[model samples]
Target: MMHKPVVDENERRARQEAHLLVREFGAEAPLYAAMKAEKAIEQKDFGRCARWKRVLEILADEPPADLRRSAAAK
Candidate 1:
């Protein structure tokens, strides 16, 4: 029997958010979002930084925006 891969809630959320952002912002969404997170970090806002970091975890593994657009087109 084959085992199903375990699903990660954070990863799932990141992908879904990636799709939404790509659609909304086109090519720049991922970088734009990352910049926002970076800004949060710079400002020492732990709460916002934590939220963005959580959503951005798998974003590096996944392509920034183009991959998201192609996958959503399917």
Candidate 2:
């Protein structure tokens, strides 16, 4: 019998928060996508990493106004 790994409650909550952010902030979606890509890389999940990388690239072409403002402020 194989047991499923238990997910930490905090990690689950964080994922839910990230999904909410994606739904609420269209422009900030890529930032979350990039973060997912980083996690995929850490897990050695190349396919998921590649998918998120593509999303990040596409979203990066036209950054959200908030991102632009933040970048300009830096």
Candidate 3:
């Protein structure tokens, strides 16, 4: 008979959940845009950051009524 270590499924699930949360926040489209802007600032990439920041700003603006309505449907 071979002995094997048992893994706790609950712990694995918890780690997966935590990883998902981090990814959701980290790679979020809008958040990525914001982070890009910040990175550009650090690198003195004014033009690049300006473009990304503009994108972030535009995304932050109010969406059209229809879009907002549709997004709220869920």
RMSD (Cα, Å) for all candidates, in order, is 3.6, 12.0, 14.2
Candidate structures ordered by lDDT, highest first: 1, 2, 3
Pairs of residues at least 3 apart in sequence or in different chains that clash in candidate 3? none
lDDT of 1 by residue, 1-74 (tens): 99989867755665666667767766667676688689998999977776677656645556656656565676
lDDT of 3 by residue, 15-73 (tens): 33333333444335466667777999999989777667655554455333422343345
- Cα lDDT computed for each candidate against the true fold: 0.68, 0.62, 0.53
Clashing pairs in 2: none
User: How many clashes in each structure?
Assistant: 0, 0, 0
Q: Using TM-score as the measure, which candidate wins?
A: 1
Candidate 2 per-residue lDDT, tens place, 6-55, comes to 97764444444444444566666877887888999999999778767765
Candidate 1: RMSD to truth: 3.6
Give the better candidate number (1 or 2) by TM-score.
1
